[model samples]
Target: MKGFKEFLLRGNVVELAVAVVIGAAFTNLVNTFVKGVINPIVGAFGTKDLASYTSCLKGPCETGPAGEVTSGVLILWGSVLSAALQFLITALVVYFVLIVPMNRMAARRKSLAEEAVEAEAKEVKLLTEIRDALVAPLR
Candidate 1:
């Protein structure tokens, strides 16, 4: 129980939970955008629904009243295309909004840490020189 409480309270655990919720919400927004905006744009060429676009691989391809495939093989290329577009949009947004900024911040922190180390090393060297000079005069 104690271990479980600790794990739940951990910074990363809470962050991960928040990230998951945000990601799910983002996914819905992307899906809605693709369906509302992208589909209509593509629909100008043909059907409004991308999933309705299909290639019949065999003879006598048929669909029921509900658009279910009744017979023959169908390559749902449009649905695949829609999914691909969604994935691309998600990846692009995540890369730019999250990954890029995080990488830049990490680089900044690393440079700052290096500068601190360099400054400390210089200070130590100067102190050593001063100590040596004082000892040489005493001898």
Candidate 2:
């Protein structure tokens, strides 16, 4: 269908897919930073290591219900924390990289339009003055 084709080709859908992929990859990077870099350094003083900080009592992986979470230890809050941090970082990066630049481009275009309008107005004013001067002699 034409509508389906249009939807498939829409820029927003493509952009959103790209953003989701990038965000997923970035989250992995943030997890590495939190687990390898931040966790050990901070865990030295804390009660548990980053990996064990959020674990499941009876689950294969603590991030979520592994196969069948028998007990809900809820130590997996550490990964949640890492995810939240990643989200904040992603938002800031997107705002600065994409939104800010887009706004600036729009503002620049508006300024150029205003300048062109002003130039046109000046030209009209000069033409009117010349016409009045010529008519004055005739009067």
> Best by lDDT, which number?
1
User: What 10-residue stretch in candidate 2 is worst by lDDT?
Assistant: 60-69
- lDDT scores in order: 0.95, 0.75
In model 1, residue pairs whose N, Cα or C atoms come closer than 3 Å (at least 3 residues apart or on different chains), thus clashing, are none
Query: In candidate 1, which residue ranges exceed 4 Å CA deviation?
Result: none
* Every model's TM-score: 0.88, 0.60
Candidates' RMSD to native: 1.7, 5.5
**Would you list the clashing residue pairs of candidate 2?**
54-75, 54-76
User: What TM-score would you give candidate 2 relative to the actual structure?
Assistant: 0.60
lDDT of 2 by residue, 57-116 (tens): 545533335644454555567667656766776677779989999999999999999999
Q: Which has the greatest TM-score?
A: 1
